[model samples]
Target: MIVDKKNDATGVLLRNGHIVLPDKTYVGDLRIRDGVIAETGQLEPEEGERTLDCSGCYVLPGGIETHTHLQLESMGTVTADDFETGTRAALYGGTTTVLDFATQFHGESMAEGLARWHKKAENNCYIDYGFHMALTEWNADLKSEMASIVEGGISSFKIYMAYKNNMMLQEDEIYDALSETKRLGATVGFHCENGLLIDVLVKEAKARGNTSPWYHQWTRPPVFEEEAITRLETVNALLHADHYVVHLSTADGLDAILKARSSGIDVIAETCPQYLLLDNTRYGTEMSEDFEAAKYIMSPPLRDKSHQEPLWDGLACGDIQFVGTDHCS
Candidate 1:
């Protein structure tokens, strides 16, 4: 296990291990004191300091989970895990920092929404946490509010392109948010989906008497997300701004990001473990009686089996930038 700087005065050391960093990994001895890294490489423990044998283990920085929904109220249901439970679980699983969304409701101010999230996680988190403001209404006032928000420590903002009738922002609204945030040196993330189209499809499916949960996947196919991502990137390219696409699930979507990058757009893709390990097969079929599949249901829903391997390869070749759990539970 890797030792992290959490307990400031607890002296902990890991002996003989491979340390992983952004550019390379190397054999070293890492030590921590008072919640700070005291030394690394060719280090001998003090007379009474504690040490753990890490001969074959890889000592890496704490995992930073970039996409998670804790204490989130969505889809007419409150997500099961709140900050207390979620952060504890993340720590147990080796994650030390989490960036969760502070969803600003349609009529509220950004600072109000951020403060609400802060109240929820303050003194409740086991590790560090950062909030990404989820902007719904983009206008002159909210654009002005973005400045203080960045100063308050939440430097990233994201727009939803997937929940049209809900939290999703429109084309012009998206462009406005990106432009304003970019001007503030803050990065924006997107939940890409052609929400207008999917909204129509969902209505049509329900009109035709299809009410099963599986219809979730049936209505919002990969094209919804892929197209939305491409559209957002096209807009972003015009702004020449740096942006991140969250929970990217489809091979086609990755292809769009790759194509944009080829033209000099700084597009970053974040993929969750579910996208890499799960696929549409879990939906079974219209005749199968496994409503349990709802457990796997999420936005940019799982893709085909054919896309999984390519995601792994994308990670290996730098086409993809990072891995997150998109942990909502």
Candidate 2:
């Protein structure tokens, strides 16, 4: 079992392990003092120092989870894991830091949303944590609050182009918010899906007597995601804003991003493991009850298997910058 060496004043030495670095990997020793790495390379144990023989083991840096949704409430249900349970699980899996979305619900101030999240996480996280304020509503007052939010240490913000009547902002609002965030030198991330089109599609599906989980994927196709992404990128290009696309899951969407970046748009993107490893087939599976497919339901729902390779390729070529779990639980 691994041990916690946070209070080891005399320091702890990890010897004879293969250390993985950005550009190279080599067998070496790493020494830690006061809970931080103090040195590396060939080293002998000093008096009062605790040494661990790490033969045949590999040492790597801790992970930073770029997206998470701990203790979040949605659709009249709260997530299964709170900040305490979620962060503890993250730590167990080697994530050292997590950036969670502090959502500002409609009709609420950004500060109130952030304060609610802080209350839930202040004494609950097991690892370092930060917030990316998600602005569900935008206005002159909300725009003014951006500065204070930044000053309070939130350098990133999130907006949704989907979830109309709930978390989504209009195109003009998104453009204005992006402009404000850009002016403040902060990055904005987006949930890009065509909420309006989705609503129409859902209604059409239900009218046709299709109410199964399979209709969930059928109603929100890849083109909706592509359309929303293209729209966001077009707006950002006009503003030259540094922005991010969260939970990107389609080849069409990736193509839109690639085209935008080729023209020098300052946009970055992230994808979840679900998109990389799973596909829409999960929704059509004839296993258990049809509702079983609900387990895989998420925005920008999984695409066809044909789309997976492009996503993997995007990651390998550095077109996609992060792989977050979008860990709702």
Candidate 3:
């Protein structure tokens, strides 16, 4: 965890690392020159070079954080972290890059939306960042804009199955978005959940006086998400396009994704730390003492304790390909 004061030409030698890989780990050394890796092996430190002793520590690539929401205004509340603090946190966690969503609200221009995210991040962020436009409202003109966006250096897109009233795209609209992405040779990621079903469940919970933090989980059960993923898998089959599911929370949802993949559906599964570690028990805690459990209330709410082991097992077996914090703040 130490850095050297030597000049760029001198380069710092990171000595004796427990290097990690997809399949294994090994002891090695890495050389950094002018802020980039120059060499790695049983490297001998150059004369007068700065050196960082990484003895007994793991050397790994800076993580590529694929999901984050910074400086986002949603449901009448601004998120906790802005670009500066969010990227700082990522760097602290060993992530050097982030791919955050740049949202185009209903009736907003795509160019303007991308520009706004840029202004928030360009000079202010502490680490590298990129944007994935969340296509909230799609139409003929907006669909045509996809090509220009890709040419402008942003390629992937997103659609929400939740946020039906505000950000969600229906099944047909979802197809259209994925079709456009396929035409542009790009991919579309979805927030999988039946927004309509969730709405009904939420109202039911409220009418029954179940307004505690726990009510959020009741409104969006595992089947709600599993249904959405199942539906999207069918559509992705027809379109045969590049696709992804974001923040997959339930074990049943993971089961659906694995089924699709096993059947040769080319799709990526992305899950978050909350799903892998936490559970709906937090809601019960919030109901009892810690009112802050409401803070844990998010779309595709956490599942039962039984889901935790399955999600971890899925990650271990490669059914789930990657992980993120889903760091909205």
Please provide, for model 3 over 46-127, each residue's C-alpha lDDT reduced to its tens digit, 9 standing for 90 to 100. 9989888899889999999999989998889989999988888888989989999998877878888999998888777777
Deviation from native of the Cα of residue 4 in model 2, angstroms: 7.1
For model 2, the superposed segments whose C-alpha errors exceed 4 Å read 1-6, 286-291
TM per candidate:
0.91, 0.94, 0.94
User: By summed lDDT, which 10 consecutive residues of candidate 3 come out lowest?
Assistant: 1-10
Global fold similarity of model 2 (TM-score): 0.94
Query: Candidate 3: TM-score?
Result: 0.94
Better of 1 and 3 by TM-score: 3
What lDDT does each candidate get? 0.84, 0.88, 0.86
Backbone clash total, candidate 1:
3
For model 1 the local lDDT of residue 310 reads 85
Which candidate leads the pack in lDDT?
A: 2
Q: Encode model 1's per-residue lDDT on 125-182: one tens digit a residue.
A: 8888888888776778898898899988888888888776677788788788888778
Between the candidate structures 1 and 3, which one is better when assessed by lDDT? 3
> Per-residue CA lDDT of candidate 2, range 1-329, in tens?
12344577798999999988899999999999988899889899999999999999988888999999988988999999888888889998989899999988878888999999999998777888989998877889999899999999999998888877788788899889988888999999899999899988988987987776767887889999899998998787789988999999999999999999899896899999999999888887533245568888787787899999999999999999999999884
